[model samples]
Target: MAKVSFDGTSGFEVPRHVAIIMDGNGRWAAARGLPRGEGHRRGVEALRRTVRAAGEIGIGILTIFAFSSENWSRPQSEIRDLLGLLRLFIRKDLSELNRNNVRVRVIGDRETLSDDVRGLLEEAEELTRNNSGMTLVVAFNYGARQEIARAAQRIAEAVVSRGLSPADISADKLSEFMDAPDLPDPDLIIRTSGEQRLSNFLLWQSAYSELVFMPTFWPDFDRTTLEQAISEYARRERRFGGLAAAGT
Candidate 1:
């Protein structure tokens, strides 16, 4: 990934990879006495703005928690609306994303999705596969625990069938089996709607990521909110489980 300081902001190193848990769409809609579907529509706009913002700022990768595996339990109407919005996003925005030189990558359970939805996800990735700009990873129907378990299952299978030793499976090797292994680990993670928990977004990948909780809803998020999150990220010291550097 290219190293570009964020507009020469002194004392701040821009994160190479930033992940966001885009929460509170339903809540935002309810507070306004509107249907949850409207909130989701607006969230798509937010995602568009965020992608452009990340690219303009030279961030290498931006991963978003769009939908979790547990979200399947929501109301059937809401699920339909959510899936509809996803389809609309791909059909409407795929060209723009490609024109902007952004690469789209989907990381989640592809097998569980319906045929049409799966096709759309694959289309988004295939259309923008060779873009040179920032990579946008959407974690739809993704759960960290499930992802880790799947990786472990793969490792076990490899050991048994491929003559690979179990002891050779280090953390780095294990991550190769996880989703989006080619993407770098998140340097900073931001969750909106004042949520402090990860909610099973990126458990294994965000092991040492700096976290920021924002009070803004997903529909209201813009480049300013993203910059604020990055600014907050800039204020921290990442020790990666070690002691702080000298001179504080």
Candidate 2:
């Protein structure tokens, strides 16, 4: 595909919900003869650009796959570095998020995170909770299978507790226990570094998402890549198991 410049004239409508799997940081660093941590350090610039682009483009909900549960299997030092980077990112980016009217939200088992990092996460979320702007969801230490399992547990507990019955469980009801129940399913999912698989990201929510895979590494992905992905999404036919034209 060729690069295109969308000066607001393109037939591109901002997706109501978009999710990203930021990949290839370590590979990018290795290719550049730099340490993996240095790659992650540069990747934050891409995160900033993508979030700001989401806001600029009017995307209502944006979810980023920051750290997965499997990521903990990496070398302990690397994991520590990632956590340190996250803490620093939260502290430095909160003000920028406030300036842009973006609200930060985290989806995952946050209890496992360090106390200091958790505090910063909570404070950032609280400060921007009321902002009527784009919602930025960071999935740290997250796994979709675990999320669904947790949702199922919640439903079972409710059924056993008092008024709910096992037969009352439904898809919508099951989704209530998800990390953020208010946000809609992702309309588009972009995976950088040319990955085609989901890697268990938003298994239930992304059932109907249009996927865009880019060869550019996460650290190299820029505003142009964002536009390209959006344009590709615009070209997709999201049937959702129905007539394509019938879809809004």
Reference-based lDDT, each prediction? 0.90, 0.87
Local accuracy of candidate 2 as per-residue lDDT tens digits, 86-119:
9889889899898888888989888788898778
C-alpha TM-score for every candidate? 0.95, 0.94
lDDT of 1 by residue, 166-207 (tens): 779899999999988888899999999987999998999989
Of candidate 1, the 10-residue stretch with the lowest lDDT total is 1-10
Name the best candidate (by TM-score). 1
The per-residue C-alpha lDDT of model 1 at residue 191 equals 94
After superposition, the stretches of candidate 1 with alpha carbons farther than 4 Å from their true spots are: 1-11
For every model shown, the clashing-pair count is 0, 0
